[model samples]
Target: MPKMKTHKGAKGRVKVTARGKVVAYKTGKRHLNYKKSGKTIRLKGKKFVLFKGDARKFRVLLPYDWR
Candidate 1:
């Protein structure tokens, strides 16, 4: 009888693509980057899809995002 609210945190951090896949930025680039390799630095900010299991979980948190 009640509508579900979107998870605010997830809404800010995750994005739903036109095809309905959940995309999120990779972690571990925020600090101590000087010690990391060039390749790691280059790769850190890229977006990636959530695994099927995890995606299923986010689907509920982002109920309206699938459409």
Candidate 2:
């Protein structure tokens, strides 16, 4: 069978952790940072684990187990 192609867009945005969980960075840090507090900006820099339902969807896009 042919291998599935990894989604480039998802590859760049989300990542799989050592525990096989899908984590993605929070948005709203790209623009208008002047109005956002420093803590808010800092928090956005961190990656958050996706919900079970959402993670399952990401898994399909990131076949071959990216870690």
Candidate 3:
């Protein structure tokens, strides 16, 4: 048997919460801010839980994150 490797890219971009929920920052926060509204920029800075389907995918990438 072999251990699974964590996906480095996902490791840097995603976070696993204490409850095992996967979270990630909303996109569109970087670049071209001048064209986006203030509210849009503010919302983009917040972290949001990934949808169930997506979270499952990230879980595989972050196997050791589950406690």
- Go through the candidates in order and give each one's C-alpha lDDT: 0.92, 0.90, 0.91
Candidate 1's displacement at residue 5, Å, is: 0.6
Query: Candidate 2: worst 10 consecutive residues by lDDT?
Result: 58-67
Worst 10 residues of 1 by lDDT: 49-58
Model 1 per-residue lDDT at 2? 100
**lDDT, candidate 2, residue 15?**
82
Q: Give the Å shift of residue 4 in candidate 2.
A: 1.0
What are the per-residue Cα lDDT tens digits for candidate 1 across 1-67? 8999999999998999999888999999999999999999889889999888888999989999997
The local lDDT score (0 to 100) that residue 34 gets in candidate 3 is 100
TM-score of 2: 0.89
Task: Single out the weakest 10-residue window by summed lDDT for candidate 3.
Answer: 58-67
Two-way TM-score contest, 1 vs 3, winner: 3
Ordered by TM-score, highest first, the candidates read 3, 1, 2
What pairs collide in candidate 2? none
User: Global lDDT for candidate 2?
Assistant: 0.90
Best by lDDT: 1
Q: Which regions in candidate 2 have their CA more than 4 angstroms from the true location?
A: none
Cα lDDT tens digits, model 2, 1-67, are 9889999998998888888988899999999999999999999999999899999898888897755
